[model samples]
Each structure stands twice: as structure tokens, then as C-alpha cells.
Target: MKYSELHGNIDRGFNVFLLILVSSIVFLLLNIFFYKFQDNISYFE
Candidate 1:
């Protein structure tokens, strides 16, 4: 039972880590896209 509990905890931690990693990547992509969009707008002007 203790082993199972430990395994469960590890799984939860891994999932959280993956979530954070994915979110950060998405945030970076959004930031890059926003910057590019702004640059295009300025170019048009």
C-alpha cells in the first residue's frame, strides 16, 4: 500500500510538471506571436 501511495504521488507530480511545461511553452508562443503581430501593424503604418 505504501508503494502504491508513493507511485501515485510521483504520477501526480509528473502530471503537474508536464502541465507547467506545456503552459510555459504556450505562453512563450503567444508572446512571440503578439510581438510579430505588433510589428506587422507598425509596418503597415
Candidate 2:
């Protein structure tokens, strides 16, 4: 019983870590793209 509980906890933690990594990467990429777009528009003004 104890072993199973430990295994479950490890799996949950790993999943949460992956979720965070993916979200961070997506957010950073979107931010970079938008920033470039903004710069281009401003330059044309």
C-alpha cells in the first residue's frame, strides 16, 4: 500500500512538471511573436 501511494505521487508530480514546462514555452513563444509584430507596426508609423 505504501509503495503504491509513493508511485502515484511521483507520477502526479511528473505530470504537473510537464504541464508547467509546456505552458511556459507556449507563453514565451506567443509573447515573442506579438512583440515582433508590434515593433513592425510601430516602425511603419
Candidate 3:
């Protein structure tokens, strides 16, 4: 029972880590795309 509890805790920690990693990556990608779009609009103007 103790071992299962430890495993569950580890799983939860791993999931949280993965969620943070994925969100940061997506945020970075969106920022890059937004900057590129802004530059294109400014260039056209």
C-alpha cells in the first residue's frame, strides 16, 4: 500500500511537470507567430 501511494505521487508530479512543459512550449510558439505577423503587417503599411 505504501508503494502504491508513492507511485501515485510520482505519477501526479510527472503529469504536472509535463503540463507545465507543454504550456510553456505553446506559449513560446504563439509569441513567435504573433511577432512574425506583426512584422508582416507593419511591413505592408
Candidate 4:
């Protein structure tokens, strides 16, 4: 019983970690895309 409980906690932690990693990657990609778009608009002006 104790081992199962510990394993569950580890799984939960790993899931949270993965969520944060994915969100950060998405945020970075969004920022990069926006930056490039802004640069292109400014160049066209």
C-alpha cells in the first residue's frame, strides 16, 4: 500500500513537470513568431 502511494505521488509530480515544460516551449515559440512578424511589418513600412 505504501509503495503504491509513493508511486502515485511520483507520477503526479512528473505530470506537473511535463506540463510546465510544454507550456514554456509553447510560450517561447509564440514569442519568436510574434517577434518575427513585428520585424517583417516594420521592414515593409
Each candidate's lDDT (Cα)?
1.00, 1.00, 1.00, 1.00
The best candidate in terms of TM-score = 1
Worst 10 residues of 2 by lDDT: 1-10
Ranking by TM-score: 1, 3, 4, 2
Q: What are the models' TM-scores?
A: 0.98, 0.84, 0.98, 0.96
lDDT of 2: 1.00
* RMSD (Å) per prediction: 0.3, 1.0, 0.3, 0.4
Error of 3 at 34 (Å): 0.3
Task: Estimate, for each residue in 1-45, the C-alpha lDDT of model 3 and write its tens digit.
Answer: 999999999999999999999999999999999999999999999
lDDT per residue for candidate 2 within 1-45, as digits (tens), equals 999999999999999999999999999999999999999999999
Off by over 4 Å in 1: none
- For 4-45, candidate 4 gives per-residue lDDT tens digits of 999999999999999999999999999999999999999999
Q: RMSD to the native, candidate 4?
A: 0.4
Please give the clash total of every predicted structure, in order. Answer: 0, 0, 0, 0
